[model samples]
Target: MVQPANKRLVTEAAIETRLTTERLVTEAAIETRLTTDAASRWGAAWASGSTSRLREFFAANTGPRVAITGAPIVGTVTVASQADASALVGKEVQGGVYINTPDLELRDFRIKGDGRYALIDFGPFASRTYIHHIEFDGQQSKDTNAGLGVSSGTGPSDLRVEWNNFHDLNDAAHTRPGSSYKYNFVHDPLVWNTAAWGAYNPAIHPHTDGFQWLRGSGEVVSRNFIEVPYKSVSATPNTNSCLIIKTDVAAIDNVTITENYLNGGTRTVMVNDGGFGLPTNISFDKNRFGPDFNDGIWQYSNASSMVFGSNTWAQTKQVVPTTNGSLGYRSAQPALDPDPLGFGCVMTNLGYGAAATWGAANDARYVRALSGGLINGIEFHVTVSSGNVSVGVYRGRGRGLTHMPYDLVATSGTVACPAAGAARIAIPETWVEPGDYLAMSCDNVTMQLLLFSGTAAPLFRPLGAATAASHPLPASAPSPASPGFRMPILVGTFV
Candidate 1:
């Protein structure tokens, strides 16, 4: 009877063990299904390639991946050693991240800062640092010193910055030579009052830029969407340019800027000589410029060996002229006019009576062409203003002559005089050659022109009676009785 009871107990124990094993298996299956569904959702979100969705995923994810919190990185974090750099991967950093390591690869991260730079690399010149798959958010910090999204130290480190989003910063990046920037979206730069931020002279302050290359060479900036809106949210031309290639620190050479979608800013692109001399081998090609700029498409000063080709306006699809250049005495006289005496020159049709001797024809001043090009418009500094005036350009009859005759070429319709300051008048395109004199005439107004007094062997304006019409100025201007006393300030936009 004892043996039979022991067998019954063993059988019941075996049945209980089987039931526990089945329950454990069912729970494991349910956990696997939940994990698979979560992974599928994550895959779909990533495949969408939407920035907002990706940001959302990063915000919600935990464990190995750091999420973007939209808050400033706590303090200055230094990734000085190789181990530190390796640990920085897949992390979200607040405040500034200073990198001083070599061959460091920083990926899958977000950096928010209120400092001079979100990420600054002080690595060796040939460190070959790679930064990608990152978001740099400036958070629109009102800190006056807040600066670029990414920047390098004094050395021109070899950096590859790609596949990143940069916004709300003073500038997207300020790179030196041997840097390549591609597949980046840079927009909505931070705007600040120049006066409030007393760093730069208030006049030229808030010099925001998309990609600024202060110096160095062998840099390639391609396939980037850089937009510096013409007006800030406060509706001001606070943004400066999309790209600025300047040799502020040292000379730059062999820089290529191509296939960029650049829009807005006061001027979309600015290539300055930087007083260090012209940047060599600067290439800008196949870039689309948006029409949202406040000033012009691009302005380059003294660039040598520059290749500007296939650049077009996005809306009109018109090719941006490579030869679009400015001509005038302003380039020569960068400072204010030293002589304050105004040349009280009256327009031809203005009732000057006896004073008509100093009228349009007599007051005409010629700008000698340094090189051959077409004049599209005229800009002049106005001292005293009067009524509406018609501006006209005339072609010189003789080369290398002081008091040569001129033939009317093109003239603008009636242009109203501004209260005071400079004015621009657009005229029909007219051609001119080297050594040719481009003279200007105005009708039906009285204004004081900027004067260059005591100019030797002056190019005198020919004295003539007031022609009935200011435009189509007399077929041949009369010869001058005396050498001109003053040189009037007038410049033309040429191409």
Candidate 2:
């Protein structure tokens, strides 16, 4: 049994050492800077074969505490680092607000495919591991491929994926748990039903993502952006929500989801249950969720609330179907019955301020004429789905208002009613704007929410000679009493 290829190299070359940035330029500074511009590129590098000299150079000069490198990688070229990582991620093209296409491949390391997904070594030249700022593309597929994978073997620790973007790859959205995936872009990397995340993994397992069975925690997936395109008539529109922490009987705690944006995903946020029960102290706050291809915030499709909310959903907007010019429809003839009668849209132009009673499928839209006073309250009514259902109101400049609101009307519901089985509720329209609002569905059943304002300040009072009809005063008519004053409260109250 001669020494294995990976083992023999580590001991003889003293590849387990450490190094620093400035040292690479020194005669005895420790690291051997190769094609890498930054000496730290090979700081703790290691690899498997003769091409692995890049890894050996970094490992032989370890001890630079600022950072540590993983096994040196080479695919199209032997370890393309420095400005190479940027190109692989498909950035610097047309990403506004700093969005990018994640297109990458890690072709050096290997994973045993025993179905258990066994771990392979990062070689010996690198004793420690660190995932640098890079991008990975999943080919818009929903498989178990990973940017960085973790198998059953290996007692590794302290890993960090920071300041990087993982988007536009349709692989599973799950990553190694217990690893800190923060301040990095984890967008649209893809989702292939990958199971469970070691979200608390600092390196291999950091012990803070609510998975406690491993007695590990403290890794987080936070403060980045996520986006998925609706498969606009293609085949499969690339999309999936944030992260998944399957119920692996692992106790996960102190998981934090904050200050990020998730746009156009038809799935749930952070999943807290997997039959193994939700990890404790799990929270989601200050995150922006917008118009998904489907629902906004989906906690569970087969279960109930698994995670609590102290979550902050601010200024984020979603476009929805409202009584606005584009979505509204006016009734050409009010002679037709618009109750719970039709199945599809029959009437049109049911614009704002119109009564909230129409058949099940009446096309109606309404608008409000305000005089700059608080909107007071709203009274809404509607029927429910005969099957399980959920309903809520949406108001926004560009988002689903129900994504975050002052009050949550109802959660789980069944049957077909809006007040009993139905919900007749009062929503505070305390402050109204030149904005728009609409009613939408939360469940996949017959959905409806009819609404009207509680009481609004009058725009102008009638002169007794006019009502909504009668001897209605003309707009340019002279007053019966004062000079220069034609519109006066002849009968209605001012306050």
Candidate 3:
């Protein structure tokens, strides 16, 4: 009795209902799978006690968040000497404090500072220092550099900073070696007023950061909430990063950053070697990144023994991809002050003199590989290019006396000299193990290559002398015990 159109409509409705049911079932399956995965991961983590404190410290609904009200001020106290700092056990006090002594404990304090730092410790070395349960409010002092600043004096300071609130400052903390920063909240950095500063010059205005590790080793940064909002009040870019691991002053090793809620900045985390050496054992694991950031999440350069795992987004819980970048002479050097030319030069064992004359016909420089990977090509800077050059890879001898190239492996055929600048010689993809040596040879002495001097030079001895042709390097290159004055900027690009 129904028309054909009515029957078609009913059939379509039934199909649509069935499709909706299937979609719901699929979604439910996905939800169950995700829940199971999360439970398994969390259960293992909890059982081991590795992530139990991290879960309880930064959980939005259950964690005890840091706030200014938590530090109830008892009275105002000025800590200038070791005696004064040692006396601040459980008192909730105010004002800037200087800490240069060992075995001191500071807790439950509210520091409102207008100076450069709330707690400053420029130590020869301060061991067993604990700072916790404090609030550093820089709202009253808008021009503060950091809430806490600890410099690596002669060695590790061995300071532990935890459970603190830091806000309204340029940077929350600037730490060095032998430090552990955990369970702290650092957010809402001071918005730069461009009108007052005329322009946003980084030298004068200073790009803000949450934590800046200038240099050193054996440091752990975990379970913290660090955020520097993008365009919070102003339009200009004033913040640098939430965390910056830099080796400008010295080499860094054994630094672990894990299980933190990090957000904002130009880049949220930046690890730079500064052409000093490859920072080793640098790990970034199980951290969560927030949505608000001007640039990407993270970047690194010249870092060896690096581990990046289980980093996820806070909103979606999806894994974040690796964003790797390099700086210094390892790639192309930026046009900053104290350029590569200003670093001066050193004579290579290949018979190049201090004046850059090719004294020896066949001279070579060897650099140890900090990581194991397939090298695609060799990048080097030619200060005075006249003749062709060749690159070679060789097996290292043993661990201790492996300064020079031991056994021949692979070599890039002689390539014509390029003009004075950065040049790349593409070689066959060669597999290099960690601690292997990369060697370079020049045909003529006039072919001057750039070298690094001062603190930026490599710590290991890398120069070797050999009398051999450009195509096939010598079987063995003998190196001296002393590191000498210069390090050749011969970098191997990896696949």
Candidate 4:
């Protein structure tokens, strides 16, 4: 934590007398009230205010452009020079705000700067950064996903984009950053990339994706409300998806997705060309998806390492079987971040997973069930060699070694998606005991789990299986180990 100190900057006049320029530091801006988006620095919410005098507000601004620095730049914020977005290679940017400035005093509106947007080529972005509560209503997607993007000049690392909303993107060439969390609502969902035709207007432009991350993108998505975009008269630019994450193991890894609601589209969620498959080390948890869609959290390619967690669904195509709790994506989450736990296995309940690929003898042998409930969708992470891996479930009464139940839950074998074929495995339902642990890891990397207690219905446990050769479990929420995610399966739903 960056603590505020007694030592302070002695006014700009005092500093100007000594230094050449007031290169406002990321830390100092918060103390001096000069930087409006300072809250973002400390993992806090970014802020911006509105004003009545829209022009005056935008005219009297500094940095990047005239109307977007210091405080929340409303009215009209843009770049002083219309150059390529890549030009912002090394320029450091503070947080973005969604409020009115002293001048603009505008209400409930955030406008993007004109011309090409900038990219904070924060090399590899070792540090965690965020863009929240702001709106890029008038911006044009210069890259894959939206107006502003973070692409390093050389190294490619991980970055976080959250809580922000984008709508009415002007242009939609393939240039947009295809890999991002499009949980935000795009009022004018699609404005196709027909820029080549030279006959484009917002009114006639077809609607498309809300938030989509194509190949070469790896980031977590949660707490977003996504809707399907409108169809264009001449073209169908957008499909319905809160997220369109192209699956390519080489491009993305360790992406955590949770707590989002997507609905109303030709395809409600997970629209993939199967260029590769889902990125590796990705987890989907606690999201609510509704009707008017074809598939529920699906991918075709053999991208490895993906987990789907507790999510709710109201589908029109297949009614997502009750047993899908452990099969398809979602079907739900910890509301608050559980306080840290010590280092040990805090096994309380047990969730049932199945592997039919092991052959029909074991395929239809076990039941697809969770002893706890749906909300108790437990998670356990382990490392497995790129082959058929079986997870040994060792449940115990508390943490005592002797108390470890002898095979309380059936051992689960992953349907390991090899280059040739993939397999299906039932997700564990009730395996955790709902308590914090010191630390948990299966193979080597730290793993998390959620064995929820079904809230809406009885612990929806399905007991059927086929060759676990190509099908994998649904989107498991992130932090499989954290507390607060409880399905609280009601006994009444059983009848």
Name the top TM-score candidate: 1
lDDT of 2: 0.30
TM-score, predicted candidate 3 vs. hidden true structure? 0.48
lDDT of 2 at 199: 28
Model 1 local distance difference test score:
0.58
Model 2: per-residue Cα lDDT over 46-103, one tens digit each: 1111112321232232212133234433322221342343232322211111111122
Count of clashing pairs, candidate 1:
2
Higher-TM-score candidate of 2 and 3:
3
- The true-versus-predicted C-alpha distance at residue 181 of model 1, in Å, is 0.4
Q: Residue 300 lDDT in model 3?
A: 75
Each candidate: RMSD = 20.8, 21.3, 23.8, 21.1
Badly placed stretches (over 4 Å) of model 4 are 1-109, 113-129, 139-158, 170-187, 191-207, 214-218, 229-237, 247-250, 271-278, 292-297, 302-305, 314-495
Candidate 4 is scored at a TM of 0.36
The TM-scores of all predictions, comma-separated, are: 0.50, 0.36, 0.48, 0.36
Q: What is the C-alpha lDDT of each candidate?
A: 0.58, 0.30, 0.59, 0.32
Name every residue pair that clashes in candidate 1: 73-94, 73-95
**C-alpha positional error of residue 282 in candidate 3 after TM-score superposition, expressed in Å:** 0.9
Assess the local accuracy of residue 230 in candidate 1 as a C-alpha lDDT between 0 and 100.
57
Task: Give lDDT for model 3.
Answer: 0.59
Using TM-score as the measure, what is the rank order of every candidate, best first?
1, 3, 4, 2
Sorting all predicted structures by lDDT, with the top scorer first, yields 3, 1, 4, 2
